[model samples]
Structure formats: structure tokens, C-alpha cells
Target: MTVALWCILIAFLLPYLCTYVAKISGGFRLKDNHDPRDFLDSLNGLGRRAYAAQLNGFEVTPAFAAAVIVAHLAGNAELVTIDVMAVLFITSRLLYIICYLVDWAILRSLVWLVGMGLIVGLFVVSA
Candidate 1:
């Protein structure tokens, strides 16, 4: 429960951090009312990718939490491994977003592999 809660918090915060980074790099005044389309475009696709990554995190966390809870309810305390997995997923997501923003191709792909591994690992170990 604590792990899921922290994951939810990080999931929410990542997008906000991405948005702020976009604003700073795009030279948009953090206060003025301006079109997001233009500002985001100026960030060169990283802003969009960051937003997508955040969405992905939000979508995945709930199912992961549910599975962990189910495992716990079934008397499998090892479900805590799922909690650790969720953390790894979040970390990889952050790395993926950062790598994409910086155009680090090989490293970005590796980060993506880490995220996928976490998801698969959760199911495999839980079973």
C-alpha cells in the first residue's frame, strides 16, 4: 500500500516536472497565458513524449497495485516484490523520458527494456 501510494505520487509529479522543463527550455514565461501547442513544439517532441510517459505510468500503476494486493490477500507476502517492481518501473520511466528528451538512442532503448522487464518480472514472480 505504501509502495502504491508512493508510485501514484511519483506518477503525478513526473508530468509536472516535464512540463516545467519544457517551459524553461522553450523560454516561455512560467506565468504568462500562452498556447501550449507552440510552447510544447518548441521543446522538440520531448514534451509530448514526457506527457505520454506520464500517462503510461498512471495507467500501469493501478493494475500493478491490484495484483500486489490480491497476492497479499491470498497470503503471499512475497507480493512485496511487486512493490519493488513498481519502483523500478517508475525509475525506468524517468530514465526513458530523460533519454528521449536528450536524444540518447541506445540508452533510451535500454531504459525501455528495463521497464518492460519490470512488468514481465512482476507477473512471472507473482505466479
Candidate 2:
């Protein structure tokens, strides 16, 4: 599979990673599994931020996946370019999560913009 395709997989999985962070840090337990949403909702500080990040990850992943797939379907942009953008998006998301966890609001917003730009750039390059 192409690197971009691999990135789609990574994007899909990233939110779960964030949730795991929330779980581990938030003291989630088996009983919490019965009401996972409530458990996550009850988190504070880093755990809360991590949960927020996970939600954002889920929100953006589909667009990123669609952009990658559409770019591939268009077949106008070079595969390398698409791959690079995908990698950058993933990197930006990782940074975003870190920023969110540490309460770096401004930096996190900047990183989010960068990720969105990468998504748009994929489509632009394909055109």
C-alpha cells in the first residue's frame, strides 16, 4: 500500500491512542467501561484534554482519509507529494495532542491549522 494509504490507517488509530492516554491518566477501570462516555467526560486536566483531542482526531480523520483517497483517485499529484503531506499531517496531529495535553492552547491551534493545511494541500496538489 502507498504511504498515504498507510497514513489513513494511522489517522484512524490516532484517536484511540489519545483515548488510551485519557484512560491511563484518568484512572479508567473495568467498571468505567460500562459508561465509557461518562467516564471520559468526568476526566479533568490532562485526561480531559486528551479526550478532547481524541474527539478532534475522530472529527478530522475522515476528511483526511477522503482527501488522500481523492488525491489518489485524481492521480494528478505525485505519490511522493501525497505521502509527504500525509506524514506531515500525522506529525502535526501528534504535536497537536502533546500541545493539548500540556495546555498549550495557542501552539495546539497552530498545529491544527497546519494539519488542515496539509489536508487541503493534498487536494490542491492533485488538481
lDDT for each candidate structure:
0.66, 0.94
List TM-score per model, in order: 0.67, 0.96
Q: How well is each residue in 65-93 modelled by candidate 2, as lDDT tens digits?
A: 99999999999999999999999999999
| lDDT against true structure, model 1 | 0.66
What tens digits encode model 1's per-residue C-alpha lDDT throughout 1-127?
4684477567666767766666665667746565655665455565556555555556665655565455445554464676777788788878877886777879988988887777666656656
Residue 82 alpha-carbon offset, candidate 2, angstroms: 0.6
TM-score of model 2 relative to the true fold? Answer: 0.96
What lDDT score goes with residue 104 in model 1? Answer: 87
lDDT of 1 at 92: 83
